[model samples]
Target: MADYQQIFQVSRNQAIKDVKEGVFELSRSAVIFYPKEGSFDCVARPWLTEAGSRSARGIWEIEFNHKLLRYIYGLTNQFTTYSLRDCGSLRNPRTIRLYESLAQFKSSGLWVTTHAWLNDRFLLPESQQKNLAELKRSFLDPALKQINEKTPLLAKYSIDDSGKFLFSIIDKQNPV
Candidate 1:
């Protein structure tokens, strides 16, 4: 509890709330995958399963979602890393998620994604998914503006002919 408070800079109550709620909430969410077959799949199974903690017992516990067993064991194709310092500059959580996702493609300096992929990535509301302008106004444009202003990565986006959102990410530290 004290460790959580110090690590996250939160009060005792906040840390308890985070341990009881925030941590579990993130684990309860599902992962979305866009397969090479040009189809999307929603693995509704969360990556974390509930192993309810008992405060009086002096223990906090959680179990990994069964589907994550392989990855958890260290067999993986993709490895991604991000700077916590860079993420701290962003106010919106979604923007941080976007920046992290963009970082996965940093080496290539490009990311082309479909509407369905974004619909799942953002868990965007139906109205925003249906309305491109709303998505741009409410999500993309603002996130990019923050990234451009605060991070070394410069983001420029356009909706290409195939109706895919194309992002060209250029790292100022190493333009590639």
Candidate 2:
């Protein structure tokens, strides 16, 4: 099994905190990615690239595979939705840009998806899902604490195992 080194403690915390703040509006059952204690996966790194390179982080994007999205949807009974540049349609890139990234996918700029991150995967079953209240009381808030307990700059990106589109988070400095 492969393993994604938990990046710097600060980045890890920031990533987790970002997830907590981003999902408050949604119901508690909403399932976001949780980095396992030790997993060789699409690990989260600060978006640190210039404008064009595929790996460049400057464009500010996070990625995940299709299976991840389905898993999250299964847990929450609602798929993650995006607001493209405030337009309110998932199809509109500009509207989707208006919103921030889910902390689970640590980048802070574009609402995005990518193929590279999907090669490895984790999944959940419909019957294995959690209720909204239980998620709120248990997983949700604790995610933030988990971040604070570790450090402050927690961030990451999301991707499904199929390398399909899932979702991402935006950098705090540049609000969408």
Candidate 3:
């Protein structure tokens, strides 16, 4: 966990530097979670503090609304930590989201969903990629390929009679 924190710190610093250098602009409102209880949003922009400053005092910190701290604490307590290194290495956001979501199913290692469900889950606009074949070509194949090659887990996907995608994770140690 300490190693992950270090990695996160390095990545965060680089992102901050990039934003400061005008490499890219980030959205003012970044939402982390939206549960029934409340929502957690990130501060629009964060700046480094000078030495002896009151808040954060010489360190770079992104201020979040108070709700986020509670949300993070609850999340940490409820969930087990998984290696972020592999997920961070993924270039595709969809792949990373899918990988993390699948990690939640470590016990069963199986997930099934329709193309419509996948489109909604990944937040792809309906106007884009209308058919299953197109979805497979543009999104599914690439994400699966990257996940299988770059991560420790292996993924196998198939289409059922109802045209739903069935994904099963193969245990690397107990391959059949």
The per-candidate count of clashes, in order, stands at 0, 41, 0
In candidate 2, how many Å is residue 37 off?
37
Instruction: Estimate, for each residue in 77-169, the C-alpha lDDT of model 2 and write its tens digit.
Output: 444342222221222222122222343344332235433221122121222233434433443344433432332223333445764444434
lDDT of 1 by residue, 104-174 (tens): 88889999998899999889998888999999999999999999898878998999898998999998788
lDDT at position 13, candidate 3: 45
Question: What TM-score number comes out for model 3?
Answer: 0.60
Per-candidate alpha-carbon RMSD to the true structure: 6.9, 19.7, 7.1
lDDT of each: 0.80, 0.34, 0.63
Give model 2's TM-score versus the native structure. Answer: 0.22
CA shift of 17, model 3, Å: 1.7
Model 1 vs truth, CA RMSD: 6.9
Q: Model 2 misses residue 66 by how many Å?
A: 30
How high is each candidate's TM-score? Answer: 0.60, 0.22, 0.60
lDDT of 3 by residue, 121-144 (tens): 898755434777777777778888
Which residue pairs show backbone clashes in model 1? Answer: none
What is the total number of backbone clashes in candidate 1? 0
